[model samples]
Each structure stands twice: as C-alpha cells, then as structure tokens.
Target: MKTQTLNVGLVGYGMAGRTFHAPLIQAAPGLELTTVVSRDAERVRADLPDVEVLSRAPALFARPDIDLVVIATPNDTHFPLAKAALGAGKHVVVDKPFSITLSEARLLKSLADEGERLLSVFHNRRWDSDFLTLEALLQAGTLGRVVALESRFDRFRPEVTDRWREHHRPGGGIWYDLGPHLLDQARALFGMPKAILLELATSREGAEVDDDFLALLEYEGLRVTLQASSLVAAPTPRFAVHGTRGSYVKYGLDPQEAWLKAGRTPAPGWGEDPLPGCLTLRDGGEPELVSREHAGLPGDYPVYYAGIAEALLHGTPPPVSVDEALEVMTLLEAGLDSYRQGRWMKLKESNGLRKRLHAH
Candidate 1:
C-alpha cells in the first residue's frame, strides 16, 4: 500500500488562505493541498492549478477525502465553519483569534476532545524571527529578569478599505484582527496576566470601528504592553524588552511575512532577518551602559504545518494546541470587557473562563 498524505481542505481563499495556509500547508512534508473552498475558483486555480476548488465550505466538509479542514474565513464565520467541519469528522485548523468568543472556543475544544480529532489555531507570529529570538534570550537569561515588554504590530493603512475586517461587525477591527498575534506572543512568553487594561480608538477618519488599540497585561513586578494601529506612519520597534540587567530593542517587523506575501516559498535561509536588535546592558555598576547588536534566529513558519502534520500522522503535539489558543481567546474577550468598563479586568483563580479551562 502507498503511504498516505493528509489531505487538507482549505476554506476561504482570501488573504489568510491564499498567502499563509495554502502555501504553508503545501510546504509541509506529509500534507497534500487537495482542495480549497472559495467563491473565486478562477483565482484559486490561477495559484493552484492541480488542486480542487469548491464554491462552498459545506461541500469541502462533506468530501470524504479530506483529512484536515483549515478555516481561514472571517472571525465571525470561524465558529460555524469549524463546528460543521468537526461534525463532518475532519480535523480542523482555525486562523486566530480562535473564534469571536471564548465560549465558542471552549465548545470547539470540547467537540474536538469528544471526536478525538486534532484542533489547532494558527498563531504564526509565535515563529517570527523577533519572537523566536526574544524567546531564546529570555530562556538564556540574556535580558536577566524582564521588567517590561512591549509588542507592537502597526501598519500605515490610513484609508480603511472595503473589507470584512474593517467593517462594524462583531469581530471586525484591529483589536480582534491584530490583537491575537501580540496577545499570543505575550501569553506564550509570560503566561496569563493577573489583570488586563485596554484602550481602543477610532484613529482613522470615517472608520466605523476601532483602528488603534493599546492593551496592558499586568503581572507581578512586570508589565506587558501590546499595541496595534492603522495610523502609525513613523518607524516603531517591533519589540522592546527591558530587564534588570539590560534592554533588547529591535526596530522593524520580521521579514518573513513580507517574504511570504511576495510569493516566496520556504527554503534555505528563508526567514533569516537581516536587522539585528540592539541590547543595552547594565551589568557594571559604572555610569555607562554597554550596547551591541544581537542577531536574531531565523523564523520557521513551515514548522507550524510540519508540527500539525506530525500530530495528525504520528500522534505528536499540534503546533498551536487548543488549550493555548483558548488562553488567548480568554484574554481577547477580557480585553473587550476592560475597554467597555474602563477598568482593568482582574484574572484571578475565580475568573470563570480561564480558570475553568485551566482546571479542565
């Protein structure tokens, strides 16, 4: 008998599906780009001539050959599509913020558990060069005890486009769109915060929902700030981590997203970021601080799909596990409560969503 490759059925061939999921899924060793559900069959065929393109997600879920269903649809559509896919007995991968609500994420996790199917979220930012390098530095104590960390995902899209994300829908806006990436990275580094404070703004003219946001994750003796905006024209550091011994600041975002956007496939030296972060050390008691460039680790986005394939094929762990994604979802929803109430939402042991999930 021939070796079996996991057949992936991707829903929504828009930006997430076309740029990230489809290509990364194709690059994985034990995964096959078998089918895609999209309204524009011509567009999908132009990019993937050999793959099958269907007009509806229900059709993709109903197909017997599909082993994994990757949901790259809008945030509001994620829950329904994923639920149906799982009901059809296909393993699922949801593009983040997991879903529009924490309750939905928990329900999905329960369904996956009952069905014995793999359920993962796409937190690709965890593998960015900046994030990877920072993770290494923290593990090696290069920054000593981190006191403050700031993660930003800013862009210069001043004019709001006619897109689903920019609309006034339930999951539309920069907070829901970009917040997941920053929050996931922070949670992955520092775990859940004790409390969360959020400030949202409609910075752009004629914009319906918030286009800029700032969130503060509070921990004991440490503060993690996550920000994203559509009006940031000036240059900003992708990461600025301050610790007892030193500070590591890196300007410019990772180049991996641009590489993928430019239609570059993963290969040798694909994710090696050219810009090195500057680390200022205060190891000495003297007045002067020492500063030097710190090289970043190459990003490995392909590893996500590779890990997913391993989990499905060999019973290894998925790249972005359901529990981890649920944690981010809890924060995402809590941040909204903070923004609405104009107060920090404490996340104690009694907090229903996170606490109960952790207990489980």
Candidate 2:
C-alpha cells in the first residue's frame, strides 16, 4: 500500500519546535512540515521559508490540510494545546512533561480516545547515544541483574533567566523541565518503582522555582537515582549502571541537541559520542575495566518523528504511547508528593485506576 504523507502543523518556534521538531519532521520520510504557529513570522521564515506560519494556534487547528499537530509550546500550555489539537481531529504529539498534572494527562488521553486520534509525548531522549548504549549492555547481559542506576542531567546555569521555566508557576522548575527525560528513561529501563523519595530545592541565588532535585526510585532489590542541578560546574557522569556482573559508566551528554542548535541536520556520524562509556566486569573473579572507543550507539532523534509518521500513515503504534506517558506522569506526580510530604511515596500497581488504564 502506498503511504500518505502526514502534514504536521507544529505549534511553537522556541527551542523545542525550531531546533528539534522542525528538523526531525523534515528529515522523516513520510512527514511534511506544512504549517507552524509562532508569533515571530520572520524567525520561522529564516529557518523554514516555505512552511506556512500562523500567529495563533487556533489558526493552525482550523486548517484542514494539517493531519498532525505537534505541540512544542511551554510546559503550562501543553495540555490545553494538545486537547485542542485532538479536538480538531488531528493526531497530537506533546513535548515532554506530558502535562503539569496527572488529571490533565488523563483528560487528554480520554479526549484522544474519544476522537480516535493518536496521542504521543516527545520522549526523544530514549534515542540518546549514551542511553542506547546502556540499553544494549543490559540486553547483552554485560550488566547482569542491574541493582543500581544513576541518571543525571546537570547544568551550570547559576543565573536564572527570565524564562517561563524559571518562573514560580505550575510546571516551572528544573525538575519539570529536565525530570521527564530522566524519569521516563528510568521507567523504560525498569518498570514502575515501588516507592519514590524526592528532595527539591531552589539552589540558585535568584531562582524562583526548583533549581535542584534528587529523586530515588526504589524497586525490590534495585535503587535508581535521578538528579538534576543548575549549579554544577564540574563534569558528572550522565549515566552510571551497576549490576552483579559488570558496570557501565558514561560521562557526557548526547551531541544531537548541540548539533541541531548549530543548524546541522542529521547525517553520517551525526549522533556519534566522542566520549565512550567504560564497562567494568567481574564475571569470573577479579573486576577489570575495559575502555572501548565509540562504544556507545548512534543517537537518532529523527526516529521519533519517523515512527510518528509511520503510525499515522500506516497502522503502526506511536513511538511513545499514551499509556507510557501516563506512567511517566504518575511518577512525576509521585515525586512531587514525596517532596512535599518529606517521605517516600508508595506506588500501588494493583490499584483500580492503574488496572483500568492497563499501564504496564
């Protein structure tokens, strides 16, 4: 069967939309960048000259040619914009932190189901070079029965800018902004944790929202730590996975976002990680560290859009499913509750709501 190209109407021209969504949508084979909703028309034209630009999201939603609506707006606007797009009979993709609240996420999912539209979140970090490498190591049993994992997304942004993410509002904090990436990756590796303990703080001098956070997710015999801070000046390992047989420690972030910001498209050797992870093993007796060059897998951000295109054009499932995102939302909320209560928040897997949602 011949596949129909999905026309994507991207809402927002900020970092997420311009740097990530636009380029990947154009790179994906079965997707077309049809329209964009941004107040800055010149900025949109500078990057995407041929793409139609609208000042308001409603204008893009009213257009009949847009088959898919990708919401890359600020954190607070995600739920409303996605709800509107789904209501307009368009498949929707909302960037991470699916919603500020779990109730909003549940409502969006219900709306998508009622409208028979595909709803997905842009959890693109699953394709990061370091993450992919870790996944391969775990699957190969290079790391046997993983017992502990540490995921960090630290930055040295000591000065708080006047951005929406820094404001004292719902979904405005380092946790909400960067937490989804770490939390989603953890949930993907290990299913929902038994409990979560979180510590949140405003470390920066002029920070209004949380600028630092540490969350511990507890499993039966495993403990996963997810952390992010804006005051870290020194280098830290992005991922540290330890198991009974071996350990994989990777230092450095994925290079795709930097490459995209520099106006470079995904090409040959695009997602190559210059700093490879070190694998230390003790399978037999003594622990020996092995250093291999370019051991990490190549990162591919375009794959998310490619899967979205395939899902909409054909009958395939979305790259990030609604239930998967819902699980992330649940964890996000649980972390916040843990922070507020100053204790561990237990997750009940056998609850009625979770059972009805069929979340794995």
Candidate 3:
C-alpha cells in the first residue's frame, strides 16, 4: 500500500462530477474523496455519505486539507474553478474541453507552471478497449501504415434537453462535448494533422447550438475523419481504419462509460468489450481478402486516476500531460475556425499547439 493519499475535492456534483470524477477518484489508489462542492448536498450525500459536501466552490477551495481539486462542472465554469483551485495550491484536474477557448487553456497552463502543480485534463477515452486495441494494432503494423481512419461518436437523442450542454452558450455544443475525445484519439495515433476542415450544424428543432458535426484532419499520408451526431438512428462503426495492408472496423462504443453510469466499479471483466473488431487482410499467396475478428484488450479508465496519483506521490509525469491537453484544445479551436471560414485550417509542424497559436 502507498504511504500517501491525495485528498481530492471535486467541484461539481452534476452529471460529470457524480458519474465520472467522484467514482474514479474513489477507486484510485492513493487518492481520497475528501470533499465535494455541490449545490445539491442531499444528492451528494445520498451517493457519498461519508465525504463532506460543501455548498460552494470557494468553500471547497478554502479547505487546506484538499490536495487536489477536480473541476467537473459545466464547460464554461471549468476555467474559473481550475484557476481558483491552482491558486489555492492544489493539484488540478479538469474534465474534458479544458476550457471554451485556447486562450483560457493557455492561461490555466501558465498558472499551473507558476504554481508547480500537476494539471491534467480527463481524456478518458484514450483507455477505451477498442482504442487500446487499435493502438496496439498500429504499433504492431497490423494495419500496416494506416492511410485513412474514421471515428464516430453518435447518439439518437433527437430532442433537445434544457441542460447547459444543449443550450446556446459558449462551449455548449456537441463539438466541445465529444470532439475532444475524437481529437485526442487522433492526436494519439497520428500526431498533429497538417490541416483540418470542420462542418457543424444545428439540425434538430429547438436546438441552440450544433448537434451534429464532421471534422476532417489531414495528415501527410493519412486522412482522419471524426464525426458525431445527435440524430444517428442507425448504428455506425465506432472506428474504421483503412491501411496499406488491411482494414479494421470496430462497431459499438467502449462499454466502460455505460458500465460506470450503471454504477459498476472496476473489477474483473469491468472494461471488456463484447464486440470484437474485425480485420480484413490480404492472404499470403492470394488476392482474396481474409477477414478475422481481433480481440480487444480490456478498457482501463481507472488507470487514469492511478496515473494521476503516481504523478503526485512519486513525481512521475501525468498520464494526460498539459501539452497533450493543449493539443486537443488547439484542434478544437482550429476546427471552429475551419467551420467559420469554410476552409482548411493549417497547423504548426508538430507538438500540436504546444507553442502559442500565433505560429499557426
């Protein structure tokens, strides 16, 4: 057992805080769910009976016992909460879509640097079973030199809810909601794209912001297209990769999120995906394409918090580095520019958005 524990104060007890952050922090070794900042103390207490629940973020931040502050609130509030957390001398973790804008993201980075505190964004999909399998395949040259890849995160919610995500506000859209996962996954696989083109739409009635989107990331020899929709009635392959050697198509989202939402903690078979991805490859001696099912490695969302604990307790680098988080933000902002300009937005050579945006 580890000798140290990082007491985490989660700033929101809303959907994200309750569904994702609280549970993950509780499960992480060397981390304690010390306090939660929420408007609904009853709800928080119903779930985490032992943990303290503060009525406001400032109250939580004032507590000297909190070693880490996790901002899992609404998208727009991420910046202020995280900034305050860092100012309070706490290691920080912000849920995805780090902030609404790249400038905000940079400011947060500067704060973390000045404070010498660990700061990371939660890009949990990196540990998805299918994505993990895909990464292994690419590393093993299973899909030799991938030329084109399509990643889709689709849902069938046609009705617009009154939630902050669906309302008209800065950072209130599907692009910010789901784009980070796809962008981070693409960056993980193919570094920075040479250029990017994005299209967004508000297709549903009563929708205030974009609910459907298609973004194309152009690489030197590869093209990665990321798509998400609110009205996707039929099923779509979650990922389809075409390469020089063969193609691998995987359907179904990683089961971890669903499992977590269903209130199941990590255990044996926790992250297993029932649907195996299929690989189509040319035979050794023939022109025929051989198809086979590829078993995916188990998904491991718990590893993210574990890594955070290790980084704080043992001085290892964070699993989701600030640079990586910035890269995702860079594309996110660039994608918006592409949508606005109706043209491809060019990116810097490498280390996507590590430098300031003036270079791009």
Question: Which candidate ranks first by lDDT, i.e. highest?
Answer: 3
* Candidate 3 local lDDT, 1-360, one digit each (tens): 155987889998888888888898999999999898888999999999999988889988888888989999899999998998899888999999899999999999999999999999999999999999998888777767778899999999999988999988889999999999999999987788888999999999899999999999987667789999999999899999998888999999999889889999988777899999999999894889999998879999999999999999999989999988998999999999999999999987664321221111
Clashing pairs in 1: none
Would you give me the overall lDDT of model 1? Answer: 0.89
Ordered by TM-score, highest first, the candidates read 3, 1, 2
TM-score of each: 0.95, 0.94, 0.96
- CA error at residue 252 for candidate 2, angstroms: 0.5
- Could you say which candidate leads in TM-score? 3
TM-score of 2: 0.94
lDDT for each residue of candidate 2 in 1-360, tens digit (9 for 90 to 100)? 254787889999999999999999999998899899999999999989899999999999989888889999899999989988988998899999899999999999999999999999999999999998887777676777778889999999988898999999889998899999998888887778888899999998988999999999988677899999999999998998888776788889999999999999988888988888888775366566554443778988989999998887787999999999999999999999999999999988712111221212
State how far residue 112 of model 3 sits from its true place (Å): 0.7
lDDT of each: 0.89, 0.88, 0.90
lDDT of 1 at 278: 92
Candidate 1, position 282, lDDT: 68
The lDDT, on a scale of 0 to 1, for candidate 2 is 0.88
Query: Candidate 1, residues 90-122: lDDT per residue as tens digits?
Result: 999999889999999999999999999999999
